[model samples]
Target: MEEMLNNMREEDIKEARLMLDAAVAFRGAMSSAMRREIMKRFCELAGLPFDEPPTIVRRNPFEDENLRNNLQKFISEWCEVDEIATCTCHELYDSFSDWCMCNGLTPPTKNVVGGALRQMKMFVSYKSDATRKWRGVRIKEGEER
Candidate 1:
């Protein structure tokens, strides 16, 4: 596959460059309608597929009131007041789930909780000693302490 990919004709490369330039110009158009039309016209001229792929709009977990409430409860219950700025959320999911189960509440999935934590405007990450790890801190009155 690599060997086959390496053997590209100069004409094909030039054509791809021209298409990219057209796409860039189309992106710079002031009107969104005009841009789309230009893109469709360019595709027609280049003999390329003009069909726009279906857009996937994923629901944000943080946007859910129940999940946000659970997160707040978990933070207040489990997180230390002083260490809130340096607390890690990845480990909190298991306990949060357990708490929800015991309380007969809808238990949120770890992935959803993680995503919610990451997206919430109230939570911010701080650089920690661990190279790939970030500590989640809840913002107080929209201010970072």
Candidate 2:
């Protein structure tokens, strides 16, 4: 089924992202070139287009701006500014999932949420100060550490 395949694809993307985050956390951030290569490899395997490093929101990431804005608004309502200031892909996905359930809407896949988060300038992946977990890391442009 198409839905099942999409679900599998979402899982693949999440696993790929987790592995990428592990590499970065272990190495304290990767060079842009290194990130690109990894992104390219995964994109190729996933049949998704390959974009530059840190701009990996390749292919159709939730092109609905209204949905994205709604998700952001929902997240802001539940989480503190600092808590989501540098959130990770997993956290973003989970929050979106929760939001969908609470609204009685069909949940988007993890991959879709991850992509939309990137498009919304809210995707991050680093060791968190509060949870000490690796998830999305939201750093403002020109302010990344």
Candidate 3:
């Protein structure tokens, strides 16, 4: 379950980054305050500050490093180097949660990539059964074989 949640977190950060890209493209035409607001909102929702976008890893569970020391300054610094305000965090969270629910992911998820990668093992072993020989081996989870 934790693996699932962690995957969602990683996905959220990636999508948020894309939105930040969009924000950069629209910078001159859009209101600076509004753009900044978007960034602020995203950080707050993600439990991050403006500057401290943590390096999320899926080693054991779904926790991030605590190197994110500054909030406002971090945001400002990030804004300077990367396109931070282009995407709002709310949208990323919403999308991530919705995607997880739709995919039947359990709560407190673990390593998502691990779960997915393990599937190859299942596939290799599945065909080993004599009764299943020459039969259509279903690929997707929750699907009939």
Candidate 4:
């Protein structure tokens, strides 16, 4: 496992991030219409049928910002989402959870809260873990504080 991890390339890291971002961790109360729009956007991004092999192979890492912007628009256009009311607290939590799992992080930090607190905690947990991992790598370098 260590050798496998050591062999992972920069492209692998980039692909992982792109894949995670492309995944819709939280779609605020989407309806069939909204889902259709999302599918359309996905198809356009992929430039192939939805049934294509490797259901998620068309992600464009360079188009992250554009895709994010479009995602927000689609979410708003299809659903009467309330940034306050309709936005569930666990939404962020779910995102964090998904990111953690997607990144192969161990012992996922579970968000027990059902509201905003949960989201905040999940974000903090992921950030904290990321920070610790960065620090560990830096320390291993023996060239930085």
Candidate 5:
């Protein structure tokens, strides 16, 4: 590999370096599974042996039984699953945070709450005006934050 690189023109080497740096930057934004897959592909293309890494299981933030139960309770009391109901992501998160505070629980971040809502099988969509919202669900009539 050193001999091959030594034979390359300076411009070629510079371009290769730039490409590698870009790949590293891109990897930082990718999920672990995606990174591993990309690494495996690179190894295959380079004719190198690729050893599979041990799988690292990540615990879901909302996986705690107690937390899940509390979230469900909150949904039951504050939200409705009507077909025509809709709520924006920001509004839902604000209301969820308020509910958590009222119930003496630390509110998770908006992203975490969004993930929990997705896990609960809530359908997400955007309005005609490009506002993101959860479809078929909305806060109860009197539960607006």
Candidate 6:
């Protein structure tokens, strides 16, 4: 083990150390059975003796197709890109909530909407009055503010 460690590239060693550190940090959140199963899989992958079936990680619901479609449709129908346009965070959430209700869909939380907006390349800025708003986008005409 010492000889193998000594022969490993520095970057590989660093990455392995980081992974192990993360595993340790998250250990408290894991069930005992889960921990044992994970360790068993690691041992098997490393060519050590262990007998355990492989476990599958579940997909994140936050990436659901319906949610993505809803968000995209809302943006296309209700929002417009303009260099001078700005909408406050509160106003944005309120408009989104109304859209979701009218469409018979549950609205995502404010934080989730904010994260999605950021991922869509929308920038956040503060107005002169210290109001937080999204830059380069605003609600379209004939839409609720």
The candidate that achieves the highest TM-score relative to the unseen native structure:
5
Tens digits of per-residue lDDT, candidate 3, 1-145, equal: 3343354577776666666777888999888677877788656546664774466665533222221122122223232222222223332223334444654643233233223323323212123333222121221122211
Estimate, for each residue in 18-92, the C-alpha lDDT of model 6 and write its tens digit. Answer: 555667888998776876766664444444577665787886445656766787788778888788888898887
C-alpha RMSD for every candidate: 11.0, 17.9, 24.5, 23.0, 7.1, 10.7
lDDT for 37 in candidate 4 is: 56
Every model's TM-score = 0.42, 0.40, 0.26, 0.19, 0.54, 0.51
- Give the runs in model 4 whose Cα sits over 4 Å from its true position: 1-23, 50-145
CA-lDDT, candidates in order: 0.60, 0.60, 0.40, 0.37, 0.73, 0.72
Q: What is candidate 4's lDDT per residue for 1-145, written digit by digit as tens?
A: 3343345566654554454344555445556455555555544444435643344467433344533343334333332332222333244335444434554643123322222332323222223422311111101111320
* Model 3, runs deviating above 4 Å: 1-8, 50-145
Worst 10 residues of 2 by lDDT: 136-145
TM-score, cand. 1:
0.42
Can you give the lDDT of residue 43 in candidate 1? 56
lDDT score for residue 53 of model 3: 49
- Misplaced by over 4 Å in model 6 are 1-64, 123-128, 143-145
The candidate scoring highest on lDDT is 5
